[model samples]
Target: MDSLSYLNKYFLRYKKKLALGVLFILISNIAQVFIPIFLREGIDGIQQEVQYDKLFEYGLLIFVAAIIAGVFRFLIRQTIIVVSREIEYDLRQDFWAHIQKLSHRYFQNNSTGNIMAHATNDISAVRMYVGPAVMYSIDTVSKFIIIIAIMITISPLLTFYTLIPLPFLSYFVYQLSKKIHKKFTLIQESFSDLTTRAQENFAGIRVIKSYVREDGEIKNFTEQSEDYLNKTMDKVKIQALFQPILYTIAGLSVIIVVWAGGGMVIENLLTLGDISAFVIFLGMLIWPMIAFGWILNIIQQASASMKRLIKILHEELEIQDSKATRTIINSIKGRIEFKNVSFRYKNDLPDILDNISFSIEPGETIAIIGKTGSGKTTLLNLIPRLFDATNGDVLIDGYKIKEIPLKILRQNVGLVPQETFLFSDTLKNNILYGTKNGNDELVNHVAKISQLDKDVEGFPKGYETMLGERGITLSGGQKQRSCLARALAIDPKILILDDSFSSVDTNTEEEILKQLKEYMKDRTSIIVSHRISTVKDADKILVLHNGRIQEQGNHDELVSLGGIYADLHFKQLLEEELKELS
Candidate 1:
């Protein structure tokens, strides 16, 4: 109940609709309450005299009341139930928008399946509370109040006797509701685990098949399914008691009405019609009692789900534009500078980039060559502010990266990472993904420069070919080239190629670089690669070992220095000579 307070704004947002629904509830109950009264009149009149016209009149009145109640009942659902769906849509949209703004670290910590469960199952549960639970709660309460008030007016003592079981019913439901809330929370958690298992298995199906672990995965998934089933059964067992307990309590009240009302009728203190009306009124009370128990179940489930949703909604954004950001500066010339930059993912971990200081001039092409774990990717990430430097400053065009607006900073830089990723979309759309209104000419130009034009031409649909999930339909080199074309489509001021050519042959790499040289003449370029051949002709070459720069020079100067770069170059030359001899 406390957790559900977050939805107060939504309630207020649709208060007019809710108010109309309440009005309809009141009108429907008002009409329904009179049916018992009309029954009493018809029964008494029939005993007094055999008058068919009078009897027909009472029947017609009862029929009219029922029709009115039914119509307004329909209106109640149209307003309240419809608003629930509207709120669900708004809530889902807000959840997705917030998720997009969350930091990359948030995704690393949370599983995709868990988030999906929250978006689907949890939101639906909350919608039940907003819709059916609310509607029925008002329906039950108003019906009870109107019926009980009328019953008391007819005979106070009989009404008192009939209501004796109500206090006990209330106490029983309160205790059961606590258990329901606890069980429901466990059920939601188990459901999340079950969803996560299914999602992971599907995403890694290829890996599982390659490793011949299908039987193992099936056994594991079966265990999770059984666990979810058991948790649900436990909740169902608790809920199953509700109907019988409510009906038993309602039955007791019915018995009391008959026993006490019959005695009064024998004494001539009450008529046959009064007893008949008392019985009809008591029957009306049964639905309210049953509805009370059902509403409690819905509330408990909704509360549990709302708590989970609130946990995600309350997560703070790790990186966002602040007051210090310079919003007026919408573009950059791409003179990137790292002033004693140092970074680590966490405080306790050793630095991946330790006191690295370098500056790239507006048009310079700088290449970083390093061993596998040499922090090359981490350095490129800082340029886009994907992760900020833990110490010192990263600047663009002499402005601190933090001072530049994030959207503007990122738009000015293009990055093609080592691991290529593509959406399940057309090749043309994938190539043009980075630009707002990229024409086919731009797409074709970038595709040609990245050497992806030849591959696209070979496909049956050319640029219209739809890729499989994560571009599984394309080869490794094709995916990398597609990613390169996407980066080029942006026409960014600073271009970063982080081992992006690892899959392509040396000839294709050479051709792409030859075209890139002209395209990058006025834009700053950063290349990170392991190949000596790749960095040999750069304006400047940087050699990194561990987390620090070991050498910095052009190919000839580094070879003359006889350092780490010279060793790598000699090894590559020897490998090439050996390949030619073979």
Candidate 2:
């Protein structure tokens, strides 16, 4: 659907509040329209030598009308304007919720800064249009209808002359609104670029400083900011012409009324009170004319912004919960199998894994060892369905992995990636993040199993230490160990560690593995590592070579076979002996 149609759906949800606001506006205009009538009466009454008490009564009625108009005007804003804010809130919330449901591939292709711009600037623009623009447009049209009828009744010729410039004004507004919409779309695009550039600079500030390239980054950012400014100024120039042109049209109408109505009154064709009341009615049209131009500007900007938001909101979910998929709410046994699985990052790209078949029993521990690009990590990712295999099937407990509900499947599997990420929160909070209701006992248990407890004892605040962005406050090994503790705290039935011990010393790695052995009873564990010591004791070891499994067996059996696993083991043994000699 188009942007306007999409927004209308949200507007209709709060139509009751909007209708009440319009009613209040109509009542206020009616009250205001009576004031001019009373003024004409007071003047004619004085000219006819009416009683002082009667004139006082007309004056009193005028005051009452003004009060009623003011009160209803307040009510109009209270209802309609408040509803706009409520709709803005709902739109923002829904936008964020949709963003969260998007897959990892979506995030990989879109920048964080660009998404943030939609949430902030684009959403705010749409809100302004829905709120004030809508309110003022209704106010302007309703008041114009009532006041024009009254003016024509006072003097038809004068009213006809006053409306001559309105058609020209409408033509000008139509032409300019189209230009404004085009320029506003460009401006929003520029703003997104500026946001993306700024976010990149901030995130890579350390790299800039380390390489002494701060000046270069600043220059690039300045150029981006200037482009945004130029785009804004272009839109501003178009908007600046709008109000002045509207005022000129309105000014011409007033001039016509004064010139023609003055002659009528002098010739006794119209009374002094009648001419005075006609001008008062003409004055009411000024705001409506100006609002005509202003609302158009609002509409153009909102259209551009809503177009951008709709692009995201209407995006198809590439990975979704299938209707035929089973809902497994209970804990799943971690029996995993890969049948002739093959995967590529993109269809045109070369396969990262090809014709791979493997299986692990429910309580078995398996390890994957490979060169840097041999698909070790890709094979592990299939278990959690991070990216589905391009061909063939992945099964868990005799059922297709897709058959299990995503929430239940993920909850039972804990994965600690090579590149660890921790929130800028207390250490205790980070560990307990996966296990939302975890107590101290569970935290400590996982900490010891991951060998993270020893490091916490040296911290100033112990488990309460506040980490910096991405856990910058911790050392590399500390980050990895803490992440392990977090994953283990969830008590997952299937734990996958992808090079999780790369930063830790062999002694520490051995200690963590020993503790993990006890934790692995009745649970399946998949370890992806380069060090022979890390995976030498696994029940099965699979050596991957060039997108294919080269060998798979117990470590001793592979060593006896003198294959890729044997070669890796011998090379690692030489490196360790050299390290000891040094």
Candidate 3:
């Protein structure tokens, strides 16, 4: 949607408060207009020998009008400013929801630090523009128009003389606002870079310390901080220029009004009251002129921020889901097939997987064995549609995976990625991550199979132990087992253990694999492992080399064939024996 249209929706949501704010500005300015008239009337009343009682009544009326306007001013703020905060709340929420709906590729390309800045700082800037900035801009413009018309009506000659410096004020404000906007954009970008640098250091602090690079990191951070400082100074210097310039112009207007109107009053061409009203009107115009510059600054900053947000919000979804998908079968038989699939992360790069074909029957165990950088994880990722293949289709139960609803497709497919992440919560909560309501039965079943039950019980808090972040964290092996338990708790039709046991002890691995064997009997299981012993018993095994299938068969059949898979199995077997002897 267009940015203005998007902003207008927010306007409509809080229109009542905005209307009330404008009413206050109108009432306040109008009440101010009467002050000069009251002073003029009092002067004329005294000059014409008016009665004391009559003059007292006129003064009382003036005082009552001021009080009434003050009440309106109070109402405006009470109603409007609070609504501004409410609009802020809504905008923040919608912005977050939009980000969540974006595909995983978006997060891959954008850093968390950059996204965080947009959600917090940038959005707050937009909110300010919407609320106070919006109200005051309209208020200033309306008041300027009202005051100028009133001054002209009182005496065109006096008005014309006073407004000679107005055009210069506009020109100065325009140029200054443009410069301020450019500097502000630079400042925001610098902040993003600084945040990214700080976050990276924090995440890899152990490596930094181990490598004795603390001084280097601090130096890099200092450079980033310095750059941010320079950008902020630039913004402040430019934006500050206008405030003093605007105030000077206001002072000039006052000087001109006094000089010209003093001559008219002395010449008897204007009343003392008329000249008084003119000076008051000029005084009133001062605030709006200053606000005009401030409003221009706000608009420029908000426009720059909105453009940055648009770039992300309008980004294309790399993987599209089907709209005409129906419910999946209650119990999937777990047959998977890949037909002549070719895939690449970018169009400019060479294909990562080229024309690969594979099929696995129901309730069968298949091991995908490959070395690092051999497209092992890439192939597995395609099953759950982390990315769409460039060519051909992947099917489960004779239905194209892309045609099925993502919710249904993912419900049946369980994946344990290499990096195991757990939220900052209790161990039991982590184990039951997506399985709402804390399913103890399912949690305990998976924990036992993953051999995490023993590990969890060893903790003082047992299953209820708080883990993650800097809390009472577990070892790498324990964490992996907890992740495995999480995946298993989902009770998926197709279970994929992707290097899930790499960090565990040999005895623990043996026990987990043995338990997984029984679970795999009536389900489709795909295991990716570097250890030969982990995959030697699979019904079928495939060896992948540089994005292509090099060998495929049962472990014994492949060993007899003496290809890549056979060589790897024999090498691992010899290595194990050597270690035992030592």
Candidate 4:
């Protein structure tokens, strides 16, 4: 019950429609109860042979009342169920949006499949409880109470015998609820594993096929499926055992009513019409009882699912908007500065970047060069405030980066990451995706700069050609070029390219740098690369070693010093020359 408090708020939101559904059930049940009285009157009237037209009139009135009750029943479902669907829609959107707000750490801790299960299966289970299960449970209980009261008014002795098994059924339902909730939770978790496996396999299908592990994949799926199947069987077995017990007690009550009530009729203690009405009341009670068991199943499932969803909503947001601090400046001049900053993804582990301090003037190109894992990309990521530093501050002009609104700051900063990701859409759409208002001319200009114009020309449909997932249709170099075009389309004030030209050859890379220089004057640009050729002509070169700036100079100054920067430049030159000789 404590686990279900969050769901109760949504229930309250749709309480109006629920009240209407209950009202309709009340009207329907009243009409149904009247039929027993009408039947008794017609029976007694026919036997007495007094007023034949009166019986026909009474019967006609009964039929019309029943018809009207049926009409209200349809109206109840239409109104209340639609309202429930609205709740479902709202819940799913919030759930998805919350998932997006959660930290990257959450993704590292939880499986993709588990998160997906909460969105799809868990939400669906809650929907069933919200709409159908809630309406039916209310309808079932209300009808039983009203009908039973009417029966008691007619004959308390008959009601007593019929209700003897109800206490046992109540206890049975309570016990079943505890067990059902536990089992359903297990079943849902098993399904989460299964869904995760499917998602993982689909996303990594290339690896599986290349390795020829089709049989291995099948066996893994089968094991997950078996666990899910067993959980379901456990649920069914409990249902199979309990449903009969509920009905058997209900059946005994009916048999008891006939044996006891029929003898009363013979002894002149009850009449035939009274006995008939009592039997109708008993019959009315059975559907509600049977439905009670079904409702329990829904309630337990919904409870489990609702709690699972709330777990996500309850997570503390990692990247929260600073409420205590307001922006000191409205706009920035794009002068980027990094103070003595130190950062590590892990608390105990050594720093990925340590005591790094550098500044780029308003309109200059500064290239970073390092070996792999030397914090070249990490340094670029810090400027956009993707992950906040453990110490020190990054300032744009005079304003701290954190003080700027994320939206405004990111709009001014464009990053082309090491791994290129593209949508499965036309090449034109992917190229012009940086800014919403990007024009054809802007896209083509960037495409020429990245040397992607030739790749687009080779395609049968030119720029309109559709690429596969992650731009699988394009070669690695072409994909990077397309990604470069995307960032360039934004026309950002500060551009950060983190080893983006890794896949492109020297000639194409040279052409890209040449065109980029013309288009991106007066705006700050940071290039991160290992090849000294890429950053040699820059205003300044930053050489990072184990997350610290070991050298900073122009190409000539760094070469003269003969430190880490000079050594790396010579090593790269040697490698290129050796490759040519070989």
The TM-score values for the models, in the order shown, are 0.92, 0.91, 0.90, 0.89
How many collisions per candidate?
0, 0, 0, 0
Which segments of candidate 2 are over 4 A away from where they belong? Answer: 50-55, 167-198, 228-243, 300-304, 470-472
Q: TM-score: which is higher, 2 or 3?
A: 2
190-232: candidate 3 lDDT, tens digit per residue: 8878887887888898999999999999999899999999889
- The local distance difference test score of each candidate is 0.89, 0.88, 0.81, 0.83
Candidates ranked by lDDT, best first? 1, 2, 4, 3
Using lDDT, give the best candidate's number: 1
For model 1, the run of ten residues with the poorest summed lDDT:
464-473
Q: Note each model's CA RMSD in angstroms.
A: 2.6, 2.8, 2.9, 3.2
Candidate 3 Cα RMSD (Å): 2.9
- The regions of model 3 sitting more than 4 angstroms off are 14-25, 46-63, 77-88, 235-243, 327-331
Clashing pairs in 2: none
Tens-place lDDT per residue, model 4, 1-582, is: 456668777778878877777788778778777877777777767767778698888789779777877887787787678877988998998888898878656887797767877888888888888888877787787888888888878788888888787666656766776577678778978887898789889989999999999999999999999999999999888867777877787778778888999998889887777887777777777767666766777777788888888878998876545763345555566899899999887798789999999999978999999879999877887887767788998888767777787667877887899999888998889888768887779878889888999878778888888887554388899989999898888778898999999999998999999988987798899999888889998999999989989889999999999998888889889999999999
Cα-based RMSD of candidate 2: 2.8
- lDDT value, residue 494 of candidate 1: 96
